[model samples]
Target: MTQNLYIPASTGGTLMSNMPLITSIEELTAEVITDLLQAAGSLTESQHVTAVEPVSFGDQSGLLSYLYRVGLTYSDGAQGPATVVVKLPTDDPNQRGISDALGFYNRECTYYNVVAPTAPFKTATIFGQAQATDSTDFIIVMEDLGHMERIDQVIGATLPEIETVLKALAKLHAVYWGHQDLENLSSTFLPMDNPIYHAALPGIFGAGWASLKVNAPDLLDPEIIEFGDNYSTHLPQMLAALNTPTTLLHGDYRADNLLLDEEGNLAVIDFQITSMGNCAFDIAYFLSSSVTSETRAAHADQLLHLYHDTLTAEGVNYSFEDLEAGFRVALAFCLIYGVASFAGWDSFGERQQELMRSMASRTIYSILETNALDSLNAN
Candidate 1:
């Protein structure tokens, strides 16, 4: 049986209406707009949103959510915002099935409503967030950070950018490092020790691997394929080894999910996969998947040291050797996502395909360089 989790939007002192959830952009009616504005604190009792002009938003290819941007005008002839991005779950049955199965939507909603207030790192400000009982019907209305310059994952990050990301991530990890109360949090934040994840990940990896082999054969080496094939079984022990002194992980921490303001401060989005895990998981995932192979080869050591130094400065007590070993394991663990992303190659255009290929190349290279497969199997 699947459990349902629901999180109501932040009402910010206003009474919430019993409006039907907005599941798609087409359903963004005037009443829905008013409800959202009130919940987001953008409208007071004296002010009301009279109209909305829907604007263009994301690439429309998000597997989990559909994004929309809309400008709102108030009754008092004032504009609420130039635009705000509205995120609603993808209506596709297959995609919704995966999200529900993994508790992705519930986790994200929890992040905004429960976690963001105290999180150390910068994330998109949530004006409102809500989910249906089943977690399938959900929406997040947030400040549009689209104006900030975004790094191209295919082009990869520069040395400065890599340093910035590592430092930011270190701060986030340190905040919850070995917090005694973490286990009492929602099951949505559970580490891989949870049986639900142990049961689900293997099948997901196998399906993804099968698709990659069929769709992008040239990218897979036999060693990498075999590593992926056997990974699901080995995952339990490997995750157990890596799970100690756990912290919050920004599960999809990558260039594509990050944006930089004019002063170059980094802000992150997409907490759908946020979980409790070794900090090295995010570190390895970012370094292996978001940067070019050459960039990582050149700066991997320095980057790891930077992350370690930051962690130490924040009063965490892990040694460099510990970090290095966890990093290697994490690099191998990342192959699961690297292969899984290719399952949607047919939906990708030339540039998207190029990005996935580059990520794969970098991930495979890191796995081989660190002898990640051998390490996992040996453990």
Candidate 2:
């Protein structure tokens, strides 16, 4: 069962204010672990953590956050997992600013606190959570799901894996298709039509293109570069077209964020960009970013239909034609991600650079193959 004890520094008053905004692994001491667990009702007065060993995900972690595998020893041999995953804000000021501006930290914390328990798909269990008053800083002590097999995005995913993930994604869309919870938390899970996106994405995209010109010039040819230059001008229409048929979106649904087991169970993580949008956008983002061009060319039609079939089987009214059309527009917009990859060029190493290259190449290929921008104009 997932714990519901979320004490934000803004609202938890005296007690939570006392809970340190842990910005580093060194601050995640044995005493701090006891407080977090106790606050979440996972520990008692007599039961406390006596020692902690934290191993950081120095390079494998996301740009917006730092991750650690914290091994724990409890007093009197009280029961608990040998280790748990601790997520904290990134030390990079620029990255932290980006996270705050985009509301990434607050969104993920809120997703676990409010939405995860009833969510249809699998995700890490939140043992404890604390957000700063400004929502810029937060800590998530969650289940250590590192044992699950993670797919490599640079190598890309197989047809079977994509099929399984899409089917599960369809179910997630079906369950939250027009749920009131979406409306109740509209501010936290911004609808695609939100003006804030219009305000922020253009500048970020422009910066990304500039960064790429300097760092990864070979990645973008003139034609693709021309399309990127005109992306912001077309943003409003694309976003307007994507706003309908709203459902819960796992905004960054890709290979790296997924964990699969032998039984074929799929667990999704990284809800930083979680929002409300057309379900097809999630499908587009997943396929364009995670699968190779060959896989998409051979199986795109079948895989898309599989998602449509799965969604309709759950009684959704979306048409296959509409899904196809929305997919094209979504694919065009996925360039934002590929382009954004360059914005953090200094932060990424050779492996991450390879992954970004794969993503950018596949995204550009799919866009041209489908004439995604023309589809967007038609929309």
Per-residue alpha-carbon lDDT of candidate 2 for residues 184-256, written as tens digits (9 for 90 to 100) = 7778788988999999889888877788778777767776788888999889988988898898888999998
Q: After superposition on all CA atoms, how large is the RMSD of candidate 1? A: 4.6
lDDT of 1 at 136: 62
Best model per lDDT: 2
Which portions of model 2 miss their true places by more than 4 Å? 1-20, 38-45, 60-62
lDDT score for candidate 2 against the true structure: 0.83
Model 2: weakest 10-residue lDDT segment is 1-10
* Per-model TM-score on C-alpha atoms: 0.90, 0.92
Q: Give candidate 1's whole-model lDDT.
A: 0.77
